[model samples]
Target: MEERLQAVTTPVLLESSAAGFSPWGSILRAIPEAAGDVPALLALAVEAGETWPRPGEGRTSLLFELLASVAAIDVAAARVFEPHLDAIAILSQAARTDTADQPAAAGSAGGTSWGVFAAEAPGARLNARPEGAAAVLDGAKPWCSLAAGLDRAVVTAHTDDGGRAAFAVDLRHPGVRCEEPAWVARGLREIPSGTVHFDHVPALPLGGTGWYHSRPGFAWGGMGVAACWLGGAVGAARDFRAGLLAGADAGREPDQVALAALGEVDRILAAAMQYLARTATHIDDGSLAAAGQSTWSEAQRVRGTVAAAVERVLQLVLSNRGPGPLAFDERYAKRMADLGLYVRQHHGARDDAQLGRLTLKGDCPW
Candidate 1:
């Protein structure tokens, strides 16, 4: 296992540090130092265009590997990179499912960082109405990350038919306006998710109504996010191991409690990794949706499982390693904090409740 990926990225990026490499090698290596530097991170992201596989391409594991590698390096960088890659996957999916009139080609252009702004907020809704061969967007779309920084995004809006559809938009349009985020979060403070307002902004339709959520790729893309969560936990575990190694280097042997914590963390991470790997295989083989299972349910399971591992790993690493690292080690501190908040994308128990309901409807994996 390599130090960076523990066998996830081998045969993809490099066999070893001394083996052959690609441009992605330097970009992945530089992400750690670029934490808290959003522009630098976005620059690195643009430099590595379309570097990941679209979901369900039979190489979905490689896609997960790239996402995990980025999160393993820096969670904040993953915050910027994951959605960019996800947007690409979504656009590619549109090309496959609905290509007659889609301008999704714009999303595939090089040197562009794209976002998928599908989150809805109270009192904010974007509506798209057809105007001749084009569509016009008007209203507010909330929770748009990097709205002002990114060159373009795939924005979902209520179509004239009373259903939601995804559209590609150039963020640089004159009718587009981004509101102040009033940012206050410590984690991902560099990447503020503000609301973007559009007034007569022209949009290129990407997919049919509700295709954004209806596609199996939706679930696969979500599991990719969980892979990022897995990587963040890997980062946390590395901190614990680094602490133990430093103690041993100073002739201070690790106590039983510290060793036990490390053991438990390894167990949790190993299980999480295997689960993600299995799910990736199912996705590639077209079995993720088998046995009357919903892809949404399986993706939720991935998120919930990985989120639990992240929570426990953070606890073990914090309790065993003590406060000295959090107080003194800036990089380590940021890693822990960023992972803490990013895993909340899992939706915690609410997701569990939804999964339970799904299970009630005969969607249980077991």
Candidate 2:
């Protein structure tokens, strides 16, 4: 299973890096029509579309599946964009295999940083002037997941030409820096969620800057992050179960607390699956606006539910199962942290604002 996933992932990464587009958008479109050589891809993607806790393992599985799905389609993004698949895989594995560093240099940390998908501000206003483009990058990007050890980032910057433009910059370039200004938290410490600074880093244009935002694929691409979060939730749930079983050997005893936690996890996961299927239908019908609306709404609801369930499961395990589950130096603590952190990626106060505006304005394109 792993080999098949790697086979699909390797080539697309190579091709994408050679070109310049993200392979995610293309992979999502090809998932349904792909050949039957791999069922793991679907299983992993579906699992991510739900919820759980294992950040490192969850990310590895989802990233592999995403790559396979894209390769199945043979999309131009994979064929042309410079591929970062190997880099991503390496980072994810490192995160899973190693312990979270004690909050060190901003971008040097490894782990969940690789397996995640992050985006810059798509709608921020930028100044357009031949002289202004070189002065500075004047905007804030709230969610850059793999800001550490990033080689390149596709950023949307306002140019001096009176319009927005997107540029892909090699992070190793002159002006780029990763800043860790404290005030970050979650159950998992592996995600190097920090700021990527481009103090006038030389930017290579990626199509027209404004065009990137208007593209249907660009908007649809945001949903891919939700898929990753869902995968984490599944891994966490599995760990939670193991912890439950290890705590006092409650085998087949129908422990009320464990049963309740399981029930909550199951319910949230089911809702997430149905929501994903509905969103997939929207994609099939070529109604991107509809898909975005559904995707956004479902993401908001599901993220909150999953986050709550993960917390509940942890409480149940810790309270009922006791601390023996932690004796083996396992990753339960980190998994919990990872899930909590990743879940907030979707269910933030910003989502509430968007959802509110969507409700207020009946003119949603969907």
Candidate 3:
């Protein structure tokens, strides 16, 4: 296991150098120009999944590598694809029910992508009820990514017993209705996130009510999102470095103030990376659970740290580069916008307060 981790980490470390960014850049460029191209992106994600880390073990290193790789090229694409990968990660730990009631594991219409629609917003009330030997899903699930493209989804709905449960729903079923895309934000606009309505759609419960949120893997999955955010931060920092190098090559000396800001950016990002590594190690050693620390608390801490680092990196780059990248560099601009939007998922001060409350319960492992 150590050998496998070293094999993965070595390449990531090697690629951290200026000369090594091209490999991942090439991979991103290889993606088709079509936005939200599920079939194309899914193919890439499936290829990446071949090397996905095993279940119930420490996957932080591999997941961080993946998110960083994909996000460096296109964070919007990462937003669209990560959920599918995360759904698979969640399914690995899910309580399996009768196989007779399970949907076929194959992709929908031969496409390889999947999605998770578990956000329980007040607008859509997806309900699950027992129908004979099976269960049926009804109502809408908002923030459903890859809705029109994916063949299946792990949807959360209110069960008849008034508790939340996760169900594997086949999007190909007649009762599953995908509303037209409504997202207009520039960031993650390429992702086909919209409302999916289930009209008595046949469902297979993956786990019992409340089990989806209770699993340790659930918190691990949240940490995966933070990893992606850190990757985006890296991408942004890389762009800043490239700009500085390009100026130097042209006999232009960087401003002293700008250089200082860049130094600070480096410190911020480096600290976040180190924190991520430590957190991953903790998860792997089982020290977090052993210490009676909730995975949710750890995830929140990591997310908060990464989100702040990304924000600082973005601010410093813009202040130093003076909007040149945002105005002239398409890739940099997209990464900036996408990361800004993605990190908003972190919930800022509210999450920090939650972490504070959780910490006060006992000795802080952090």
* Candidate 3's TM-score: 0.87
Off by over 4 Å in 3: 1-36, 95-111
Question: Where in model 1 is the C-alpha error above 4 Å?
Answer: 1-24, 96-110
User: Candidate 1, residues 1-366: lDDT per residue as tens digits?
Assistant: 246443223222111132433444667767756767887887777665445566788777767767777888788888888888777777777873232233433333336777889888799999999877668999999999989887788889998778999888888788999998998988877788999999999977877788888988788878888888888888778778977998999999998888889999999988888888787888888786666788899999998998899899999999888889999998788888888888887888889999999999889867
Measured against the true structure, the TM-scores of the candidates, in listed sequence, are 0.90, 0.56, 0.87
TM-score of model 2 vs. true structure = 0.56
Descending-lDDT candidate ranking: 1, 3, 2
Please give the lDDT score at residue 135 for candidate 1: 85
> Could you say which candidate leads in TM-score?
1
Model 1 TM-score? Answer: 0.90
Q: Is candidate 2 or candidate 3 better by TM-score?
A: 3
lDDT of each residue in 1-366, candidate 2, tens digit only: 655343333322211242333434444444424322223233333233223212223232234335323422322222111123332222233332121222322333221122222354555333323333333454445455445444444556666666676554455655656667364564433334555655655544445546655544343344444444444445455556655555548565657767786777667655654554454445446453543454444444544444554455455545654566555535555444554554555545676677667656653434
Which candidate has the highest lDDT of all? 1
Model 3, residue 97: distance off in Å is 9.7
lDDT (C-alpha, whole model) for all candidates: 0.79, 0.43, 0.73
lDDT of 2: 0.43
Task: Tell me the lDDT of candidate 3.
Answer: 0.73
- The parts of candidate 2 lying over 4 Å away from their true place are 1-148, 161-164, 180-188, 207-209, 246-252, 287-329, 347-350, 363-366
RMSD of each: 4.0, 13.0, 5.3
